[model samples]
Target: MRAGIIGLALAGAAVPVTVAAPQATTVPVPPAKAPFTFQEVMVPMRDGAKLQTVILRPTGKTGPLPILLQRTPYGVPQSAPSQVPDSYKALMKDGYIFVYQSMRGRFKSDGSFTFSTAVHPDDPKAVDEATDAYDTIDWLVKNVADNNGKVGMWGVSYPGFAAAVALADPHPALKAVSPQAAWVDYWMNDDLHRYGAMRLSYATDWLYMLQHDKAQDSTFEYDQYDTYDWFLRQTPVAKIDQDYFKGSIPMFTAMLDHSNDDAFWKKQDWLGALKKTTVPTLNVAGFWDQEDPWGSWQIYYKQEQNDPDHLNQIVAGPWNHGGWHGRGDTMGRIPIGTDSGIQFQQQIEAPFFAYWLHGKGKRPDFEARMFESGSFVWKSYKHWPPRGAVEKSLYLHVDGTVSFDRPDAGEACRSYISDPDNPVPFRPRPISPTYPIPDWRLWEFGDQRFVGGRPDVLSYKSAPLEHDLTVTGELAATLMASTSGTDSDFVVKLIDVYPDNYEQLREKPELGDYGRSLNGYQLPVAMEVRRGRFLESAEVPHALTPNKVIAWNVPLRSHDHVFKKGHRIMVQVQSSWFPVIDRNPQKFVPNIYRARPEDFVTARQRVCAGSKITLPVMAE
Candidate 1:
């Protein structure tokens, strides 16, 4: 129920003219040639450092038009140059200046770039981006003649992080910002390290790739190829040191040194700095965005609670990290069935600018919009999911059942053996040529389904559903069991099983029913995993008492889905989720970073009637 912006194309120009603009101020438009003109410009930072920027302007002479800006460490040319043919053409044709800038020391920007360097109390580089962003905005508004003296900022992933930093010291011209899939706290959310265990493959590979000295001309090609190869190899990250990871090691070391939520992580927390944001903000996240979805939600909620007048809108969709990929119509594995991407620009993004920058339309109505997965429906709410929803627990039963009612019958438990040496590989099959870094692209549906039938995995399913059920909210598992060995790991998975009779109909006419349809549907739906170790707290490692029962709570990421009548809800429990999560050696060791093969041993894992996986179920 959103209103779309309709613009009239200038007689011979590419820019679309605003109907409500003053007649005297309107510029003569030319025939549509291309959406925007691209240029490379050097933006000066507050500290005198120069950052490279890619500018995209509507293809005609127009009065100071509103600006849309994005700052990123990932090179801008990688995707910004060809935006016309890409899905963002609507935004370009509608008359807005697009600016993409490189962060300090990254790509062609002048200055040393270090990941999370700004989080360090002593790091000057972190402060540089903020001041530099403010300076750049000031300069853009004054120098760019076409600029309307108002700027709106937007970016995904690392670029989103930069956008958040820019708002910390916003320029006078900057008025609206949208940060999607942004990484707020590197330690708690990012791939490098989750809890205390090392995310070996992803961290190592990422550091190895980003380690090259960009300053050395001779190292360019070598670094690119080496980094590319490392991503394909999927090696353990903990072993990488200064020898292999040059400048990048410092960031990793810093993350390791500050395991707790000390001043280090707090400095990087954009949520803590919510008071600094004065502009209208739109935050976007995805249910499957394994990297920073939680961070995005946290930022939006914090901002909404802190600032009542500021128009803050949040959109949560069913997508992985960076899944938007500049596309306006398509999302992840599904096509929008219409020009949904263009609709988003004309209806959502464009109007947002009109209201905030141009002072034109009514303020956005809803505070948050979320796309429910499995159900595939979009829901709008004044605030986040209702706070009235109580915390209800669904207990795990002995005979492979999950129920809301606690067991009054005798207590029962199920046991499985966990061997770290023969750990469950992350994907279902062997990924011999795995990426050294944990890239979602490397592990697709095939990879995740690979571990489905392993002996170490214990699966429990509900009888074919008698009625449709929808689950929405954060999920946690409380286990009351003991380990036969000193320490062990426990893993949980939530899966949606498609009915056996369900058939995928092909939409592609050429391939007929056999040909894959671009608009095809997936039968199995979705699945998620959480890894837990008995001896270690998510923040710290504690020695496990042999044969002693202890309480452990494992939290799975948030999700929304519908189990249609006859569809099954399956819960799988295991000790290890290989490759994605590193193997716990079973023996209590001080540092898993340097564990020997001999340290791994087989241990008994139990899931009894007393132990249960609790799910937050929403009444249909």
Candidate 2:
């Protein structure tokens, strides 16, 4: 995957020179007969550190040209190759110059680099990124030929974060930007944490593998693949800390230090600083992006409300994190059944850049675009969720039922015993070579067939629908129940169940079958789990009295899906989703890292009938 090559090239310190020369990989570059000349240059930062940059200049004898820039920690190709045949070619062929720069402390650049999460200690909200980008543009406008002074910027993921930073105090030449899948809030939902619970496996593995350069003699190294395998094979839950996490990356320490959404997080948030941008933007995200989908949508909403002239647009697809990069494949156990990557990069992403960078096409018609998952079709709206969509609640009924219709009788509650010692393992399915772990960690979609029948899993389902119904927008589950322990965790899953004709298989080709032949598919669409102690507030830790029910709200992100006439809507409530989410000690503990086996206990968990899952329904 060339995963370590970029890091090694960037580190440039005296170490094992085992890495091979950079590969001649193609990255959608423009053609020779094309209107632009592609060249590599090093752009200097304000601190006199040089950043590697790739510049595409318009062909002709003239003055300076307008610039389209992207600053990424990901490497910039030493030379730009021709664009891929199957992808969109408009942006490359257009006259505007394209620029990609390696961010400070990365590839061929001088400076100490830390992931954006650690930026607060070194620089202000957008100081480093903005400075680097501004300097790059400043150099391009003067040095490049056939020039115009205008500039635009765009990127996805980390680069997307860079794009957001570029706009903090933008360059005079910067005109527009599209920061898709960009992160605004780090602690709340980016890779490190989810709903105040630390994601131990992904966080540790990512930091060790990607962030820490071995040249630094960092005291962390794991057989990335085997370490997780061994942990999963262990007998009980308590051994994981000592076995895999001890002396590793300080991930647990970072997690414990920021237990709440406090000043520490606010200082790093990019959303507030983004209002300073005075140019157009197109924010993109996927409905199921497990990493930072909320941040993407939130960025769009905040921009539109705060800066009316910013030309903000949003496009959300039925995808998981980074799903737009590749063709449709199974995410864990569920199949979304489409080439979301091609659809996004070719149709929405390409056009956005073409329009903003070259003024070459019509502005996209819809203010917001989203693809409904089960129905497998794209829909556009005047605004996010549209004006008339109403928030409706589907109460969790007793006797294993969930319905939008209110319960006509007395309050009823379903109960299960939660044992942290034998906490439910996440991604219980087999491992895949492409992923870091073997379990369904990448598959955020709910698939309950594995845990449906377990005594600890409480399942509530609705009857087969008589008509097609489309649900669009955010979903939340409000549980008005209690636990029988000092502390516990609650996991909620919303699923769509297809009829028995729906077949389940493991291989890749089986994805095509599940998409076509399924008469009904009971696939989990959205779910969330929160620690009971953090329910009241992540800042304050409150212990629960045994068997006392407390009201809790678990908000799942937005999703667009059409449940066919014969399909049923199901909601699964449980106390734990282990490995993926760390086990809640079931007792109030100072930190999960310090939790002992004796702290684990079996507690009675309940979901009362009055509790419900709320969905935003767009009236026909």
Candidate 3:
């Protein structure tokens, strides 16, 4: 847990889940005979609280090396790994004193822990993640022996947030940081919620895991194999705690209390803290990142605003939450043609730190390095969305076809009945827990055909492309339609449809029973949901006018992908995405969280002919 999948320690991305009873332990005992020697110490914070820190120095090396620090709410190690973990091998080869520390009120660390990264740097009395990170670096550079004064920080997910927070008020010794798959704003597009609709499974599972115990990460045990069934069986959002959690998870309760983007959620915004770029940053993201995908881009752009020194750079690949830590040659059914993970680690990440922390290599010159899927090649750009990319409209036709040209005169719209009682599953059923379920990580890349034909889903596809079409920037869907319900959730997905006669992949022993053929596979490039209530303004949400057409803008985020020749570009519009996205209830209520079971009802959803999905197409 210390050296690998450390983000899983707190956020539960790919961590192994122990189905047995949950137990509480003060400190985690690390494996014996690790390549690095482990030493535990209490690092004093500015607020007079002590944090549990573990320092791991290379076993045989003795020369002075810069400190590579990672602060996490996840538990720190009592001992080091028996060998260099895959996640650390690339960086370890460069040599450094690795340090891991449990955040305040986590494990043996003193002081209470608030799961928010919001920090107030102006007030001396305010101590948050930023302050804690600052204090920890101050203590490490001054107290920890080894003779090196420089420090660098890197982490994935929550730890990534901590890495970004350090930039608010960085320590003098801190030189570089990488906030991979980090969360900049929780209320907008991160873990808990997307727009205004809650991410039911992730929010429910992660809250129970992170807050259930201060000493260890816990997973909620389910009686049913399919979490989709398990979640649907629960009461409304307001009664979830009463029915199961029993107030054990305070974060869930707080989320329900703040159903809207009000002050409670607004206080957690960290963009203000990062108004200026202080430390050299490598903001990493994944085009297919299921958790915390939006943050890395948000951070990169925020830093670019005032970065006259150009210390900011980004690397986005076809990775899941922490997929870059593993072998990234293949993602689900698609072969990336290159080991993107290693490329990022050895070429980009390692070099960035080498230049900034150890002064060993030249600084990265490019502003963005992205892995363009479909083409399965690495792309370098001086600016993201590359200067040559242009926004083009892909219109939806009532005949169930999509085209770059405007739709001819025909039926006004296509309709579907979205029933909350039988919501559309985000993935094929027999769905397992969000964490530990190997399939959970690859769900984003799963074939959309599973739900494409459902009565609740409306699918439209363009004819086979004659040439490779590359989309390299932000994507959005402008839906001009109406709903029978006063409140609705519009889910838009940009998909890549493989040709019926697509070339089949060679059967590898590692693939086992999974299909090797890519024929007719519907891979989602980008998908997002926007609630009708918050369409106008998130702060003042009101009931929508029933049966009245209105424009709904659904942001599909950004991606660097190509629709190869003969492959069709598809767009799928739906209402509910099952437990992945909480049921909208359809009928508007003052607080959807408090809506009764009766609030759930069937609503007619439509996609008008004029509706179009704007893609940032790279100019040929």
Which structure among the candidates has the greatest lDDT? Answer: 3
The C-alpha lDDT values of all candidates are: 0.62, 0.69, 0.87
Off by over 4 Å in 1: 1-34, 78-85, 117-128, 213-237, 242-249, 253-267, 325-346, 388-391, 432-439, 442-449, 504-540
Provide the clash count, candidate 1.
Answer: 27
Once fitted onto the true fold, the runs of candidate 3 whose alpha carbons sit more than 4 angstroms away are 1-34, 409-411, 504-516
Least lDDT summed over 10 consecutive residues: which range in candidate 1? 215-224
Q: Is candidate 1 or candidate 2 better by lDDT?
A: 2
RMSD of 2: 10.2
Q: Report the lDDT tens digits of candidate 1 across residue range 326-424.
A: 442344434444443344556676677777877777887777766666556666666566543456676777777776678767777878888765677
* Cα lDDT tens digits for candidate 2, 1-620: 49799888878877666987787988896646644467877777666788778876645525444577778776775654444334324354554566778777766767756665323223553346666777787887787766677787877788887886666667777777888788877666766677777666566555554445523323344443443364444333334445755544444445555566667666667666666337777787867676667777777877777665547778877776656665554544456677666777767776776676657688765687886777776788887767767888888888788778897677668898888666665654442322333333355664567787789988888998888777887788888888888888888888888877556555666546654544444577787778777777776777888778678888887778887777899888888876666667788876655566676678889877678888888776
RMSD of each: 9.6, 10.2, 9.9
Please rank every candidate by lDDT, starting with the best. Answer: 3, 2, 1
Off by over 4 Å in 2: 1-38, 56-66, 82-90, 117-126, 214-252, 328-340, 432-442, 502-520
Tell me the TM-score of each prediction against the true structure: 0.81, 0.82, 0.92
